[model samples]
Target: MRLQKFMAKAGIASRRKSEKIILDGRVTINNTMIKELGFKVDPKKDIIKVDNKKIFLEKEKIYIILNKPVGYITSVSDQFNRKTVIDLVSKVDQRIYPVGRLDYDTSGLLLLTNDGDLTYKMTHPSHEVNKTYIAEVKGIPNNEELKQFKEGLKIEDYITSPADINIIKKDKGKSTVKITIHEGKNRQVRKMCEKINHPVIKLKRVSFGDIRLNDLREGDYRFLTDKEIRYIKDEINEK
Candidate 1:
């Protein structure tokens, strides 16, 4: 198998991230530094090491659901000295990384796992995993604005897919709207509201695909239930 694939199977990181580890000269095969992108190695025979630590495939997989809090980055590490989701999951001995991204200011349901194939399937745009968010906007959207959101809005380079939006509450200057969309574009919910002239003041993800946040508190994480894991696996396989 390819070196990156081997690392991915070992649950160190995704194949893409493993490539970076190799490129950075952190990985070696049989005590020899190997930085080539497509290099292959047999896990049964060849010894692989990353940063001088032997790499072995994990016998068991771990999946976690975290109610991420704001001010924490979704990445494994941040160059800007900010805290990341990995920091919040330090209690977990097994390696894991966030399945997708949530902007630093956004909070709520986030998935983490050591299963690389599952991570790829979940994050891949082609899978179209639905994500739901509750957004508090600066102003109540008019009928025309709401229509535009349902029809889809253009944000710079890409035209967003049609979203399912419903007004949960409306007051003098602000309104709470629930939106469900499959595209995970950067700051997508906020950008959509901006396109409709109802800029988001606060945004929180309520659900991802079939997983709901429920009563999960911020900064807390729990292992996924067997049913939840099976459901996710089935959903990906169906796709």
Candidate 2:
């Protein structure tokens, strides 16, 4: 297999990230530094090392759902040594990467897995899987603002795709609203709310596609049920 694909399969990183790793000459095969994206290696015979540490393809695929809390970044490791989602699942034996991202301040359902194919499929914009988030914003959106939000609001360069939002509660100066969108742009929910003149005070993802956070408490994680795994794989297969 291609070097980047092999690295991704080894749970080192995503394919795109693996390519950058290769280009940066951080990967080696049999003691020889390889910077070629198309370099091939036999998984069974080739000794692959990333950052000088040998890596092997994980035989057991692990899928975990984490109720990521605020202050934890969604990454394997942070350059600044800040805590990461991986730190919450330190007991997990296999190396896994997060499927998508939630901003540093956003808390909620986040999937971590070694299944590279599923990760790529889920994160790809073409798939357009719905992600539902509950956000507390500055103020209640007026009818016109709500209409603009649903119709698609221009934020920065691109207009957001049509989204669904419903008022869940009305507080004294803030409103709790549920927003669902298929796109996973960086802080998209916050940006969308801000565009409607109701910047988010707090955000928490409730669900992604069919996977719900349920009653999972913050900072806790659980392995995905077999049925949940099969359902997601079947959904990706269908497309």
Candidate 3:
């Protein structure tokens, strides 16, 4: 198998990340430092060391649904020694990586797993899986602003894809809006609201694809039920 593909199947990181690791000479194949992109290895025979630590295919796959709280980033590790979403599941025996991102301040549903194929499927823009977020913005958007959001807005150089949006609640000074979009751009919800002159005060993802946060609380997580996993596979049309 290809080196990056082997590393990805071993749950070390995504295929692209693994390629970078190989290119950086962090990976060694059979005691030789290999920076070759097309390097192939026999997983059952070749010894692979990343940063001098061995990595191999895991026997069991693990999946987790986490109710991520504010202040945690969605990465395997933080370079600044700050907390990452992976830290929240330290008790879990299996190594995993976040399927997508939720930003440092946004709080809500996040998925972690060792199934790299599923991770790639969910995170790929081509899949276009809708992610739903509820944001408390500065003020209620008038019909015009809402129309701009639904039709798509130009944030920076990139224009956003059309979003499914609606008002969930409204008060004198603040309004809660639910927006669903298929793209996973960085802080896309916050940027969208800001463009409409209703910057987000608070944001929380309520759902991803068919999986709902349900009653999960902040800083807590649970194993995905069989039914829920089945539903997610169906949504992504996973074989």
Candidate 4:
């Protein structure tokens, strides 16, 4: 396999991050520093190390979902020593990573796993996986603003893809919305709302594909059921 795949299989990092690790001059094979993306290795014959620490493939894979709370970044470690999603799953012994990212203030269904291939598939733009969020915005959007959401709006450099937006409730000063999107741009839901002049006050991802956040509470987590795993696999395999 390629060097990145080898590193991912060893549980060092995802293939993309492993490529960066290789290019950063942190990875070595057979006592020689290598920085080529095309480099391949024989797991049985090659000795691999990252920063001189030997790494071996994990025998067991773990899949978990967490109802992420506010303030924790979706990372393994923080340079500023702040909390991370990993801190929430300290009880889980295996090395796992967030499948995709949610903003620090964003809450709800976040999946963690050691299955790097599955992670790749989930994050790939080609997959076009859908994620749903419950958003509370500053004010109720009129039909024109709602049409802009369904039709897509300009964010930074580009316009967003058309989204599925449903009004769940509209009160005096705010409204609750059910918004579904395919692209996972940084702070996208909030940004989209802001573009429409509604600006999200609170956001929570309620679903990814068919997986719902359901009754999971803030800062709580649970392993995925076998059937749920099958559902994910089936969703990805769809033609």
| Top of the candidates by lDDT | 2
Question: What would the TM-scores of all predictions be?
Answer: 0.94, 0.97, 0.96, 0.97
RMSD (CA, angstroms), candidate 3: 1.4
The candidate with the higher lDDT, 2 or 4, is 2
Clashing pairs in 2: none
Q: What is the lDDT of residue 63 in candidate 1?
A: 93
How many pairs of residues collide in each model?
A: 0, 0, 0, 0
Model 2 lDDT per residue over 1-239, tens place:
98888888888887888899999999999999999988989998999999999998878899999999999989999999999999999999889999989999999999999977678788877887889999999988989999999999898999999999999999999999999999988889999998989999999998988999999999999999998898789878777
- Model 4, 52-168: lDDT tens per residue? 988787889888989999899999889999999999999988888999899999999999998877787788787888899999998888899999999999998989999989899
Clashing pairs in 4: none
Q: Which stretches of candidate 3 lie over 4 Å from their true place?
A: none
* C-alpha lDDT of candidate 1 relative to the true structure: 0.90
- Local distance difference test scores for all models: 0.90, 0.91, 0.90, 0.89
> For model 1, how does the per-residue alpha-carbon lDDT over 1-239 read when each residue is reduced to its tens digit?
98988888788788778899999999989999999999979999999999999989888899999998889999987899899999999999888888988999999999999898788778877898889999999888888898899999989999999888889999889999999999998898999999998898889998988888899888998899998999899989998
lDDT of 3 by residue, 72-107 (tens): 989999889999999899999988999989989999
Sequence-dependent TM-score of model 2: 0.97
| Candidate 2 wrong stretches, greater than 4 Å | none
Query: Which 10 successive residues of model 3 have the least lDDT summed?
Result: 230-239
